[model samples]
Target: MQAYRIDGVVRQGKTNQDFCIDLVAENEDQVREKVYSNFGSRHGAKRRYITINSITTIDPSESSAPVVVSHFRDK
Candidate 1:
């Protein structure tokens, strides 16, 4: 698996809230599905409301310092 940085925006009410997520996945398609599944379930948002702006693989050297950590994880 590879680490990917997914950037996008989701429609929330009258606003479009931007989000960035870092996760481990195999490819861009998997990244997209994961993003949609995560946002949809966590925020009760529909797939149509989510817009993926960019999907890029993270270099291994930079994975040591991720920009956006998952808040859902236990410390």
Candidate 2:
């Protein structure tokens, strides 16, 4: 598994909110899909309403997320 930092905006009504999240995935494509699915289910935002600004690969040692930390720690 790889850790990724995804930065983007999610459309909510007339405004867009900035979001930066970390996720574990095999590749960028999977990460992108996860973002859309997550926002869709959690925030009621559609795929078209999400804009991905950047996708950065994060070194395991640099990740502060507990999910990322625990995942790599257990490996």
Candidate 3:
């Protein structure tokens, strides 16, 4: 798996909020799918409400999320 940084905006009830999240996926397309599923379950957010602006492939050291860091560190 590779570490990715996903930046985007989510609309909920007339409110739009920006979001940045770190995730591990095999590719950018997988990252998008994961993001959509995660947001859907956690926030009751639909795919249409989520706007993914950028999907960046980042080095392990550059990751801010501990889980991502740990996954790479342990490997």
Candidate 4:
């Protein structure tokens, strides 16, 4: 399985008024889908949260390392 990094101002069991979105997705369409899915759906059908932040796309520097980093951040 592959992992993707998502960065957003997640509201714990609530909605963020001044929300923002920023993160890396599998593709262009996945970007909107991911955000909507995560924000709209409840976590484990219990906790609800909204990602009000930006997500950054991260790629592995090397294959051996499992570390993922991106220059995705608020300016």
Give the candidate number with the greatest lDDT. Answer: 2
- What is the descending lDDT order? 2, 3, 1, 4
Summarize candidate 3's per-residue lDDT along 2-75 as a digit string, tens digits.
Answer: 99999999998889999999999999999999999999999999999999999998887888798798889866
Model 3 CA lDDT for position 11: 93
In model 1, the runs with Cα more than 4 Å from the true position are 61-75
Q: Scored by CA lDDT, what does every candidate get? A: 0.79, 0.93, 0.93, 0.45
lDDT of 4 by residue, 1-75 (tens): 122445555554455444444444557457757666756674432224443345444444322322223332221
lDDT of 4: 0.45
The window of 10 residues in a row where model 3 has the poorest summed lDDT is 66-75
- Residues 1-75, candidate 1: write the lDDT tens digits: 677888899999999999988877778899899999999889988999999999988754454434323422233
**For model 3, what is the alpha-carbon lDDT of residue 38?**
92
Each prediction's TM-score against the native?
0.79, 0.91, 0.92, 0.35
- Highest TM-score: give the candidate number: 3
Q: In model 2, where do residues sit more than 4 Å from their true spots?
A: none
Least accurate 10 contiguous residues by lDDT in model 1:
66-75
Pairwise lDDT winner, candidates 2 and 3: 2
| Candidate 2: residue 51 lDDT (0-100) | 98
Off by over 4 Å in 3: none
